[model samples]
Target: MIHSVLEFLTDELNTFIKLKVGDPTTTRIYLSGVTNEAGIAIPDQSLGISLINIEEERVNKDQQNRFVNAVGKVEKRNPEIRLNLYVLITANFQNKNPNNSSDDYVEGLKQLSYAISFFQSKNVFTPENSPGLGSFDPNLQKIVVELYSYSFEQLYNFWSVVGAKYLPSVLYKIKTISIQENAVLEQGEPIEQIFTQSQHKS
Candidate 1:
């Protein structure tokens, strides 16, 4: 499910960027880590979408463990675990020329800005509104994207932890990814009535 969401988002962003640049074959955005399995940095002239962190959402958690199934029987299962993912979108565009380094740096920032703009305009996505979203995950109902701001100190610490030089990037908090197991603990008919007896004390 996690992969499905990220893939859909990456594809959407790629399409958006290609249209913005007026090139149908442009593939500027991709789903990848800041570094590869060999710890090599991302390629140049690309935007990488990486999952940096996952935090459980504690508020308004579902407590119901029983629901009516299609067969009209009540089934019990564990509640879904809601999560908020911290997704980092980084731009790694640099001109190889030493004298043109500043210009290339600005280009990276510009690409990053396009990403920010894309999310700013459309922060919420649902299968109904977004075409082909259900193809990725039929169970995925909706996804909300919010810009996550961090202090300079926090940013520095993050880069240090990642063990990579800082690049033009933006962080977004993805809200409410529900993960639940399909194994039912129990099944039974719904209670049709409640029986109680009250007797006067002797």
Candidate 2:
């Protein structure tokens, strides 16, 4: 299920965002297979809501090297445009206890909301001049914010419909949704370590 979602997202992003395979300006999005966890354990519930834990795959060493090389090429070609990539990980929880209970699903939605809020609050690209400023350039910020918001909203709606059909008592629990600046994993360094450190709030 999670795999299908990842593939779907990849396809959508690829089509929406202009990118060539080897272009540094291109954002490479990868998804990690679902985590092997039983489900979210809620108090008072005998059986927890069954969940499909989906995480973003850490950028591997090879990918980092390729990105570094790509950046170099992109810099030579177009130095003005600063390339940035973002990764978002979402976990979905659905009731599989046979009995219909919306509590767990509600909790999952709350978790997802919190995660989105957290991401929004920590957005470093926000401008100081305006309250709704999203990026350094006001015009660019407006476009980016609108595009991101619309894309995410569409995804959420699509997911809601899919969840309704597959798992009626569905709840989505999102963990860490992070954006790393100038991300490049050094050789021999573990990708996990890099992501872990980057995700940590200062």
Number of the top-ranking candidate, with lDDT as the measure = 1
Residue lDDT tens for model 2, 71-110:
3331111112222223333434455454655336764454
User: Across residues 177-201, which tens digit of lDDT does each residue of candidate 1 receive?
Assistant: 9998778999999999999999999
Q: Cα lDDT for residue 51, model 2?
A: 30
Cα lDDT, all candidates: 0.87, 0.34
lDDT of 2: 0.34
Clashes of each: 0, 0
Count residue pairs with overlapping backbones in model 1.
Answer: 0
Which model scores highest in TM-score? 1
Compute the lDDT of residue 83 as modeled in candidate 2. Answer: 24
